[model samples]
Target: MAGPNSDPIVSATTAAQLPPGAVVLHVEAGDRQSAEAAFAAGHVEGAVLLVRDEVVTRPMRPGDGRHPLPSAEDLADALGRLGVGWDAPVVAYDRQHGDNAAHVVHLLRLLGQDARLLDGGLAAFTDPVATGPGTTPTAVAREPRPWPADMLPDIDAVAAHAAAGGVLIDARAAERFRGETEPLDPIAGHIPGAVNAFYGDNLTPDGTFRDPEELRARFAALGAGPDAVVYCGSGVTACHDLLAIERAGLGRARLYVGSWSQWCRDASRPRATGPA
Candidate 1:
């Protein structure tokens, strides 16, 4: 197993002050409550909290593509406004278990940013269970020219990969993968022939990703290797699994941008329900 193109997790304090050539991003992920807490308490300097709606290129295009990969220009614009450039180290965080940060990571990498998540996210900082409203951070990101990224794979690309016999792993939670819920997408069930590998399974007790060897064993059990393609409900948390797999040095994993959200929208696409 080899690590991802970059580290899976990094610290805020050190990452913030890294040399100019290095790109580190501080991304905050969470619902409003946690975001408010981290903001009120001050997050990593120069960090940006991605609002799900604002982050994506086309905010809502159901079934069109689950987590439709943003265009380079749009993504670069978003990152540029946040003072991010292709050369910066990106460190991401969330108030809780870094739920949203997972998507943030996948998207950033897709856009060609050398991004990494903050271990334990904002929670890992003080490991805060409660945070008073923080005064907004002073570190405002200075806009930089957008850098080109090539990490994300579109639905057609994924379909082609599947047709070519590449492994397609579903990283949704067990129930969701089994078509037990349809909270975000119009349809339930998963892409036919995809394997189930829950993103939550990648975590250790502290919410940080598990060790490398542990991940290798777990993924290997599923017949998945470094060459696997992973997807989740909307290409969000599935990146968490990809992060873990890469962190554990499993190998590079591609993201199916449309994921279940995209998969469900197309009735012609085969879907499977029940245990994997």
Candidate 2:
């Protein structure tokens, strides 16, 4: 899982033994008690419990997006406690929401860390793993996180990037992306030239990620490669695409944390109506 040509990040059969020197971060959104209990009982062989509020994401700010976009510094500290760094193989998960892992995946990559989510997440781990006691994976590298971002990008930056050949990947449902109905952001339309690749499309029927070759084709069509960028409403589920690209062995991608909320906030930015 260290090289550029590794297989899928998460699979059905393997709960993903954290290799010998890899860091497996098992983060669950909402409520900390359950995570602690699961950890105490047993985890994916070698896993660390990461609470959504405590260590995964920072509190949301008033002008910020609906979902909190955690600061790189805050996540760096979280990584430190979990014995993680730039090259560590991280697998974030959330039992309640099928897409919660996307948030953490985006945050980790924003800090330039090599992180991915368990495809089936908690269900996969429980199915292939048993609770009792597990051993910690060996430590491989400890390189510190990359230079942190001063702040998550707002609408202006997103518009600029969108104009600069970046792929505005919409992680919302098909209806929302097509301006059918939007229960979250103020505006009901999508960013101009944005592609509708619902976050759910990245997953398989069993909740695990789809085949890497399949993801590779979709991303290649969108032109989102190592240098490309992605966005969504409030920048939460957009990470789902980021993780998908990473899992597909395509390349690393960037996140636009503000996403549609910030874009709609500014009337000056362009908006699209029809589906793509």
Candidate 3:
């Protein structure tokens, strides 16, 4: 399912057209048990599995936000167990318009591995489904590579980026960005000088990403480019926007992993209200 130059997205129809031996991954956001239950019912044939917590993240720590990323060593182990060879063509899919899938795809790409998201997610696929326990290949003993330093930005880096006129795109909903309502982090509003580009705007009514040209225009309006950085409530959904940016051919943007949760923890970082 790798697109031209390993494009970051693939239609489910296009995914079905992939040659044999391409590794499929079912990415779902849920607790461990719920994910297992869903997988037991059925999944894409030969798809590797990644549940929200087990494969996508680590235990939350004080000031670490709701979805702290797993250590690179841990992630490498998980990848090995999934049989993701050094050059394997991997595809990640989720029902939520690639919200969860984008997270995994972004991580893989960050690690210099080739991967793509299933555009429109699982609903768009018409292939036969396999049921019951899925197989996980024996863990490969490849050297664990540390997550690229520049791919993720800490709170300090985010502040500096904004101060230096770098783009800091908040992927939260407009209301949340405006401090009008916040059901998650205690603090309302967003980082000062940060612009809101609600992640949902990247998709169409059918849940597939908007056309590349349209996406380019949308992000171009937001000053998106190599210097732009993206953040969401906890960092998971921000990957969705990053993926969209890449699909728009904007190149890889930095991610503020600690995001709002980390920014709000200090109570000293400035927050803005009522949009940019």
Candidate 4:
């Protein structure tokens, strides 16, 4: 069910839904301690743990923001150490629906690999559970490749897109987008001309993604078409909206990797508060 052009999301009520020999990754936010604890309790057979902060992002700095993208060579090497080769079909999932997994899958896709998010995440996986730091396959060799130009846009591109009347989506909580509160970053408010489309809204009450037609209608109402540019506070959760857009049949949307973290740090950039 997975190939070069398959859907970016998949559901596995049973393990059969996953492509044969697909490399399953259990993604965790921040650190590996909690992930390791969870995995020790129970996890799908052969699924390896990947801490988001450690594997996909670099240390926070003034220009790069809280979670900057890792170098292409570093990412390839990390995946190769996890036994993921160039052509492996990767299925990434996390405990928090699919937000974390979506980020990993998004990066993998940018590197020209076939990657997908496991819809419904660990809660919906019906496969047999394995405990005690499940055995990982032998490490494979992966050649490093640059991220595609069109998929990863810098702050300048996002600004130009907004000025051109393109759909610029802010995938953060409404409160954060409205400048009512600032928990993580130094700034409070979203980029001017960007519409709020919180990533969590993409999931159903059961934590699975909504139907494709439903998602299509939801995003269409927000003025997001195939050319939408999506971002979040730190450029992590925005992938949830991106995957939803692709699941909605709107094609892949570009990611603003630096996102609001980069945009808000500059005193020159204008910030807008309240609803769009």
Ranked by lDDT from best down, the candidates are: 4, 3, 2, 1
lDDT of 3 by residue, 121-240 (tens): 777777767788798665566557787678787788889999998999999999999999989988898998999999999999988899889988999889987689999898988989
Q: Which candidate is the best by lDDT?
A: 4
Question: Which digits, one per residue and each the tens of the lDDT, describe model 4 over residues 1-276?
Answer: 233335788878677778888999988886678778887787777888888888899888778767898888998888888888977889998888987889999888767678899889888988777788888667999888887778788888888998888889999999999999989888899998999999999988999999988998988887775578999988899989988887887777889989898999988788999989
Cα RMSD for predicted model 1: 4.3
Clashing pairs in 4: none
Best by TM-score: 4
Which residue pairs does candidate 2 place in steric collision? none
Candidate 3 least-lDDT 10 residues: 1-10
Which of candidates 1 and 3 is the stronger one according to TM-score? 3
Pairing residues by index, what is the TM-score of model 1? 0.79
Please give the lDDT score at residue 93 for candidate 3: 86
Sort by TM-score, top down from the best: 4, 3, 1, 2
Better by lDDT, candidate 4 or 3 = 4
lDDT of 3: 0.81
